[model samples]
Target chain A: MYLAKIYVTYKPSILDPKGETVKDALHRLDYQAVSDVVMGKYFEIKIANDNESDVRKMVEAFSQQLLINVNMEVFRYELIALSTAV
Target chain B: MYLAKIYVTYKPSILDPKGETVKDALHRLDYQAVSDVVMGKYFEIKIANDNESDVRKMVEAFSQQLLINVNMEVFRYELIALSTAV
Candidate 1:
């Protein structure tokens, strides 16, 4: 089995107003030291498949095709192997 | 400067319908290897403060009071120092 951790975030050029608002909110909450905030999405997935190369391909396809907006967002993922006793 | 990477996710007992829906969608897309999916939020924050303890405290407060729903979600963070060229 494999576990995939995926993170999807805005492209560098994209303006993250939600993040900006959160930064402002933090400042109001007395966290004045906070300078910037970028918000993103995280996904934890468990795949029953064991083929490393196939797992990578599947995650890559899912992130690119479904999880992110190709023009404004980008995604990255890490696949880790899990040991299971039969 | 410091970078705080925060992740917030639903408590294990909570029902994550969104994640379930995504998993079902993936299966429809022929990603039959996928067994489970959990989705959460990620925040990349930049803090101007240099004091590690102070930063940690601030993040702890912000996460508890604002970022997470005390009953349904839990959060974790990693603080990293960044070198600045003056």
Candidate 2:
């Protein structure tokens, strides 16, 4: 099997309310060094097939088709082997 | 200013309870297409300085030092210009 890690986030031009809330909380907690925060979604897609190339293709297609909203966000992903055990 | 979008996710070998919970939620919500959901932290670090190279360096350093745990997670980022209006 192959493991696909995907990340999706809002475009720079849009305001992120959730991130702002977290930023405020962090500041309140004395983490003043943090200036801003933007929140995003993460997903792991497990492909039953073990071929790295095939997994990459599937993840690329999935991200482009369903994982991200290009009008508001961008996404990227990585593929890794599911197991290295004997 | 520069916009730094960072994404962090758990390593594949690690068991992700959060992801499983989300998967269950989706299933309950009738979104059967979703097989899994892995949660992660996302941040947008705004740099006061607009130098792209400097911002990239700062983000890289920040991610390595405070943003992600190399043992349990991986992260990646992208840089975008904050403004283009004249």
Most accurate candidate by TM-score: 1
Off by over 4 Å in 2: A1-35, A39-86, B84-86
RMSD score of candidate 1 (Å): 1.1
Candidate 1 chain A, run of 10 with poorest lDDT: A77-86
Write candidate 2's Cα lDDT for A1-86 as tens digits: 77777778888898778878766765665545456777888777665666678667666765676556878888878777777457
| C-alpha lDDT values of all predictions | 0.91, 0.72
Give the CA lDDT, 0 to 100, for residue B67 in model 1: 86
Tell me the deviation in Å of residue B6 in model 1. Answer: 0.4
- Cα deviation at A10, candidate 2, in Å, is 12
i-RMS, every candidate? 0.7, 4.9
Please list the residue runs of candidate 1 whose C-alpha ends up more than 4 Å from where it truly belongs after superposition.
Answer: none
lDDT of 2 by residue, B1-86 (tens): 66777878888898778778766755665445445567777777765666778777767766776667889988888887878357
> Per-residue lDDT for B1-86 in model 1, tens only?
89999998999999998899889999999889899999999999999978899889888989998888999999989999998767
